[model samples]
Target: MKLLHVHSLPLKDVIIDLAALFKVDYTRNCGEYSVKIPSTWGTGSIKGINFQGGLGLLIYDCNFNTDVEIHFTVNDIHPLKFLYCLQGKISHHFENHTDEHPLSNYQNIIVASKGNDGHVLKFHKNEQTEIYSLEINRKLFKSKMACELGKAKPNLQEIFNDDLGDKSFYYNGLYSLNLAEIFEEMKNTNFDHLIGKIFSESQSFRMLTQQLIQFDDDSNEDADRIILRKAEVSAILEAVEIFKAELDMLGSISSIANRVGLSGNKFQNGFKTLYGKTANEYIQFLKLSLAKDLLVNTHDSIQEIKYKIGFNSHSYFSQLFKKMYGVNPSIYRQNYLENKKMNRSQKDYK
Candidate 1:
């Protein structure tokens, strides 16, 4: 692995450091910074924007020819960073620790190295990825958002209030879907003039808002506080197949979680993160969907269908079906049949 140490604070200095390391030139226009990867080193580009109140963004949209590890260091307090992997893969590990956090997909993680410890990012060879690092100079940001910080939750207060980087904090969670649109807009939109600068500056604050909100929510999520990593995402995906094949005999959440090599907490959290439902809710959704299919295509009675779907009570089954589809199972089936009959009659007449 090729390693380069970055000795800088603001986004501009970081871009200059990257330019020197890659043996390429960088540019600056209206305070936005950019450095393109030379063909010899990689492809695509790295861009950055520094907004007021100590908020900044660094974007990597490139593929390298070799594995590159960059160490971000500073003499004083290192900025707290919210890392977002919008696409592809990358790894992050503290300078003092070997426990690597692989970030990919739409996942986001927050890391604050203890005073002056610094951060290290590893990008794999030939894998193009777009990663966003939202850096917060806590001392400056705290002063800028003093009124807001006073009203923050106790947990958030602790984070934003840690201006000195006294604590080594790391929190990871899934789903930062809100920033996707902003990233697309920023990438595609022009940022050449003062109006463009204003647009980007506003967007930076919006991005910061989303990151802070998500970090706050993830920090206090009472259900599954376990840090789900990229390697374990496969287990979450496997759990879906188990849900599909064993709907009838599905066990307790703990047992099912154990079967999938996840703790119950992580199981629930990962399922919800990936599929937008708890395991039980996902199971219920699948059951109702299957019951609808059988109702439309088979001669099974409601009682038989309910039993086939592992539901013991017909009324409860009907209730769930109605809650999901806005009608009783019989009515839904009848409506489908009526629609099918109408379509067939029309076809025959034609």
Candidate 2:
């Protein structure tokens, strides 16, 4: 796999190209900005002015002069998008509905979607603000980078809003450095060669994978005793399916245990014993596995996939998917398509 070089253009050009790709009209200017972005491709847009630049990442200075409203209406899919506010405030609206979230200085918003419809974001401006934007295909992160990053199978939405916010030494400044290196490689190499290096040599991604495995190991100890109980295993599995089927209902381990006529601790232990995983882990696995199936077989949006897998929040779904799979779901889907194409081509040649 090769890392492809994405040519940077002026903000207007970027917006125009994105609009063309989405086949929608987006209005913006040197002043008061507005845009109607329809979901298309791996579409992403940033409404802000440019700031200091380094090697890999580009920082910007932006103020939300008016409310920034983004309307996303494609059913059953979530788009992968990231936004960082280095200096100002913003809010988010989901399903074309509004939610008030106060974001102060040095705050950021990262959104990863399995799929959703009629979602919107409105960023209100109070004072002069500076924002930094990094937009890449979610597939890039999934294929060559995410596995090395020690990310857990994250809920997609959570990965964008939470995981991305939890910056470490490797993902912060070092991430910029890595991006620079990747870009250099892209400039000097073909897509295949670049992707190969990215997949193989991304230290950030490798570290993430290591951390996730370790977390799983630590969690496994608590799960061991529970795994030994056959009855508990049966109950927990039943609970998981029930939760899956009844999206409106949820239960704790104790609740599940009570339903099975067992103590909470006993049920928990039995669940671990039978499943070789905790109840939470089992649920996450079930969701992620289901998400994988949807991404592979259906052209559903990321938001739709998130909901289908019983994740009420797209952000949470993205986070869980990343924590488990190390890459966002959108990226995984793209890779699936690319691999499928490659496989088909190989068969034809054969």
Candidate 3:
């Protein structure tokens, strides 16, 4: 394990220090700092940007050849970090503590060290890891917060309300569905530099808000804390089959997810990742598809079709069917039959 110490403050300098160790130069655009990995070390890139009110984001997407540990050993206080692992795995250790915390894919950890204590992040060798860190300089952020920090839950309030970074905080658990969507958008969106910065800063704030809400939800003693797992791919498949077979009487997302040994958030995320739709959305799609098939192939009335496909109201079903297909269910059926007859006549004449 190679240890590279970073003795720097402010995000851009830290990236500069890191790139210095890499013996490469990084680009500084507006407030963003970015550096690409050298071929010798492996592949990928590291990017960091600091926004107003002391909020910042650091993204590390790397596949390293050897295990590397980057130690943030600044004499001053370190920023509160919201660490999210989207790909492989990484670990965290506070400067003064011997115990280490592992952060795997689809997991997040919120940590803030008191005073001058540092943070150490370890990246595994040959592991393709994508980790995003939301770094908050508490002293500056406390004054810039738009909402009331007091309204937050006790622990959260203490962490965010601390302007001087006197208190230390650490929490690790499953992130929220909203955050997952935001992360996807941040990664996939393309825009000009000005618009990109604006977009990123806005998304960064939203990420902070979602993380705070996630922390609150995670802290609720009654809430179940379950991270989505890659092994649960089978569970998602089972869910799809269940939805297909039970479209006529499909239950709520909660019921369906519970039936598949996952939480609603996990089910929604996994379903979105694999199938590009939420569980509820997929269920609706199945119902509509069955309705369409039965409309053309069977003699069931619209009301009957509605009931057969688990829609509670005939008018709602018709409205939704028209909204999706650009015509009401009755018209859709008539059009299908008309087209079918015309094709049959043409074939017979031919």
List the global CA lDDT of all models. 0.84, 0.47, 0.85
lDDT tens readout by residue for model 1, 197-308: 8998788888878766666656655455454545567888888888898888887878878887877887777678778878888899999999999999899998888998
Reference-based lDDT, residue 323, model 1 = 100
Q: Write down the TM-score for model 3.
A: 0.77
Instruction: Name model 2 segments beyond 4 Å from true.
Output: 1-237, 240-249
Clashes of each: 0, 69, 0
Q: Summing lDDT over every window of 10 consecutive residues in candidate 3, give the lowest-scoring window.
A: 221-230
Better of 1 and 2 by TM-score: 1
Residue 126, candidate 3: Cα error in Å is: 0.9
TM-score of 2: 0.32
lDDT of 3 by residue, 231-280 (tens): 56778899889988887877787888889888777677668877887777
- lDDT order of candidates, best first? 3, 1, 2
lDDT by residue (174-238, candidate 2, tens digit) is: 11112333334433554344454353234324323332333333344443322222223455666
Ranking by TM-score: 3, 1, 2
